[model samples]
Target: MPQLAEKVPPSVAGAVLRAVFALPDPVRRLIAGRAVVRDGQRLALDAQLLLLMTRLEGASLTGATVPEARQGLARGQRYINRLPERPVRTRDLAAADGIPARLYEPKGLAEGSPLLVFFHGGGWVIGDIESHDSVCRYLAVNAEVRVLSVDYRLAPEHRFPAAADDALAAYAWAVENAAALGASPEAVAVGGDSAGGNLAAVVGAFADRRPDFALLFYPATDMSVRRRSRELFADGFYLTDADMVWFSDHYCPDVERRTDPKASPLLADDLSGFPATYLVTAGFDPLRDEGEAFGERLREAGVRVAVRRQEDLIHGFANMWGLGGRFQEALAEAAGALRTGLL
Candidate 1:
């Protein structure tokens, strides 16, 4: 049986969400219950409220089948995320290796403007271009750049190395077709969140022609070992340990290959020549420590890197930017960084 939230129309859901968020901070916080503090980091009040709502909805990714999980994610987005804003131009096209892709060009974008080759995150199992349409549109408009969002094949169907191969190929295609896309070939960047972030970093480390910049949102840098953040925030905070295990088991399956540099970018032998990067990590995310550690590794390898920890948020905040609040603020900051980096 569908829960009340699952059955509510998007309009009603959005209205209820807006009404709830419009309440004063104190009132909202009161409704969200007490603050969630761990490792000296406090979760934001709004994030807490969203987390509580997620629990009440009762649609969890942890135990559901692949189709059910995908449906849940898409349905949840309809309920919580706003409709994507229209870009100046949007076109469906095939990326490298005939991968499905979409191009978003912002209003007033000049010739030779920078371009971003974006990969959508879903632990390489569930997300798609539609799932990340809002994110690509937000980046395209806010950064004043063109965005090529690739719909790479997902896992449990197309497993390890498939997503990575598609990401690299799509990036190559973007660089080769940059002029046609109204962007400069030399100014193309690569970016993604979670699994997609891992792919972007992999491209940074191994692409034949490196990207000009990278934008990572709380990436899963290492799948080989569970870090402190994984244990500390394992159960609650939206992305649970069980969910991670499910994703990994489906995406990689073979435990022995988990440490491959392609799977775990943090284990890559050299990052000295990697492109400049701006990586964001959520304070309460299981992937937080590994993402920050990857930044440290990049720095040690003489690569320019900026690691920003959104200390009051949870995992998947990047996908929640449509809801406004801190999520938008964080993504806006990344857009500014992308603009500056590509200049």
Candidate 2:
């Protein structure tokens, strides 16, 4: 990858996608029609927009140049940037270990609002704080809590424990620095989508004060084994089994290491004291089975758990609230649960 490859601003990718978005609906449906979720459930109108993003993000790049993947990811970042903006005061900061993070404060939050430290999903490879900005803003306003979006290191460049380490460090930073940030240690929560969700689950097992609750949206819990969802939703969906393999390969690389408790929280022998969790799963996501499996494990361990399965939604729907049917419903369910638990 050339140094100039990094210089290709995300805005260019955004513009290209904006043009694609501006095209007639018939054209979009044609180019992206193949992005069908194999489960027989049609992608709703709003959910269909996510396929356009999937197309823009460029699939089939496992063995390709890093620049190609970067370019593809940039388009998704732009797609996130294009989501509706809501009222939230934001600031850029760093975690305790100096990992970059963005803080979003919803306007008119009650004094001493609860705080949520969030991690974005991209299989620990592509997504950044920018990619999940809209979801964070929506959470902040709707849940009435401030959110710290951690921009942890990615794979191929930084692998395995780097992301896990940063996630723990970010959560620690929030709890330790809660007072100054207008949140309390008791009210602090950690959550994420996909890879971020996996990190949240891992961090909950070791957090100092322990997170009060967890919000995991279709997290990849047991990468060591192939499950039913993977076989069932392997192709056509926004997130495919091949994509999961690509992600796990880049992030963990070492097959044996994928079973590490930190990498695969579901493999943990003891989860007795883990925080209450709201585990979300999209019916069409390849990782759905594992996410649910983790939830069942939590229940077996006596940890309170709420599982919401969005049957008609696909992977990445949590990040696509603009497609406001089941996607928004899922988001609302999680936010409402968090408000009840944290506030």
Candidate 3:
């Protein structure tokens, strides 16, 4: 729960949030509309929908199966369409290893500007460049950097290594074509939200020639879904326990794959030599603890790191760049981090 002083009143954003909160868990689960009987545990239609909505809203679907996760993302797209427009430049480009991506770059860039290669959050199953378009625009314009938003492959259909492969490819493309994008090769950064953040962290850990920095927003660092925060915020406040199970089921159809370090970077043995990192977590988010834990691990491994907890915020607040006053503050903090890292 947020402190009284940090609480946001019932503004337009707050109203929408409240409306989402007001819906019965059963009703929200029905909205997701994906259900299956697993291990003799059958979820009611409403139950599935509620779980889906919670995970999608809170960004806890890092390991969702591709089709079901895409359904959730479609629901999110409908919601995003209801919001007002912000400034952005959209383009289709070839990423590393010929992966196609729809890039969102903010307008008015000078020659040789810094660049940020961003991946959208969706537990590596849902989300696309379009899903995170608004966030990329806000960061590019406010931070005065070129933002290359990647449309990486998702899980289940694409599965574990696919998203990670695409993320690394995007990072490589950003470094290779920085000049063409009017970006300083030495000032390229990589980042994403939720599962995308996990990809960012993993890529940073393994990049042969690492990026200048990394930006993670409410990242899902542990795919195992056994974190204490998962149980703590499992019910109300957003992102329930059922949602995590759904995502994990989707991302890791094979029960044995859950333990793979590639699926959960928190299980990785090494974290040294990654770029400078800026990790932002929402206090009310289920993934909060794991993101914080990852930051601590990075620091322990001698990586330059900074962790910021948005105490009053909920998950997916980064996409709320046009919503409330706090959005500006969040943007400022993120932009400041990028400036310090890239410049």
Candidate 4:
């Protein structure tokens, strides 16, 4: 067990919010009903609640210009990470590929400890190291492993394979310079969430010195092929199909390139002998089906794969642990998986 891990507190504020947001259908309908529901599945209560909060805070990005969207997301991310954090030691570095990154080391980690090189999720476009700081800190502390969060180049500004290439390079760098950061080269793992998760899977395919394990959270395994989740949870949820389409267009301008194995690991011809892997998906996430598909393919290819579906969550639950409730518990479970897989 990790020596010093923290969980988001379920205070009075959270209780009030849930009690209000999780109100009866008739009451919700009178408030913001049909606007955020689909097929009467009721959407995840936490997700719908957050959407209502975001809408109130002016967080819609649909049809927003690139600059406007980036700024808006960055602002919200900054606010979320603004709360005081746990006492994990952190530092910044530039990968050999010149991509920026942040490293988080739990106060209790000994020399030559396990390391997870992580990539942040934003559909290959709008996330940064700062945005994912809380998640990294939580993982580093709870998993009892150091986390190196890579700030890969985003879409439109830097297109297809740019983020992929950077993720790979960061993984390589983490392996090469492990001892310098008090980590073990042989214990390094590659992981990410969403676009970052996609990048992690891409890196997982490399025949060259591969990481000991791979961890992906709701990754977009198939960029070119649309799965059932794409149609199923296309709207009202946190990550909409329209946003996916926009992200794909910006990241891979050429439709053909999106099918390339490097861009979509799910389309890879073979995935045999890949390292031990852990994949997580959210039931209500638009990318849920694709994430599970990747894990299933890897298992079928004879690789050791472990998959977990957060059946009551949304697209970005892995990164929202700080929001409290079940999200924090889910993240803690994921960290336990990370430790078990790596150690």
Task: Give the winner by lDDT.
Answer: 1
TM-score of 2: 0.86
Candidate achieving higher lDDT, 1 or 2:
1
- Model 2: per-residue Cα lDDT over 29-62, one tens digit each: 7766754544566565445665556554444423
lDDT of model number 3: 0.71
Model 4: per-residue Cα lDDT over 106-156, one tens digit each: 876799999999998888888889878888888898888989999999989
After TM-score superposition, what is the CA distance of residue 286 in candidate 2 from its true location, in Å? 0.6
Measured on C-alpha atoms, candidate 1 has an lDDT of 0.89
Clashing pairs in 4: none
True lDDT of residue 152, candidate 3: 83
Which whole-number lDDT from 0 to 100 does residue 334 have in model 4? Answer: 85
User: Residue 106, candidate 3: how far off, in angstroms?
Assistant: 3.0
Which residue pairs collide, candidate 1? none
Per-candidate total of colliding backbone pairs: 0, 0, 12, 0
Kindly list the per-residue Cα lDDT of model 1 for residues 1-343, writing each as its tens digit.
7777668886787778778887999999888998888899889887888888778767675545898889878877776665446545889999888999999988677899999999988889988988888888889988889999999989899999899999989999999999998899989999999999999999999999999999999998998999999999988798888889999999899999999999999999989989999999999999999999999999999988999999999998878887789888988999999989999
Model 4 CA deviation exceeding 4 Å by range: 1-43, 61-63, 82-86
- Where does the lowest 10-residue lDDT sum fall in candidate 4? 1-10
Better of 2 and 3 by TM-score: 2
Root-mean-square deviation per candidate: 1.3, 3.9, 9.9, 6.9
Q: What does the lDDT come to for candidate 4?
A: 0.80
The TM-score of predicted model 3 comes to 0.77
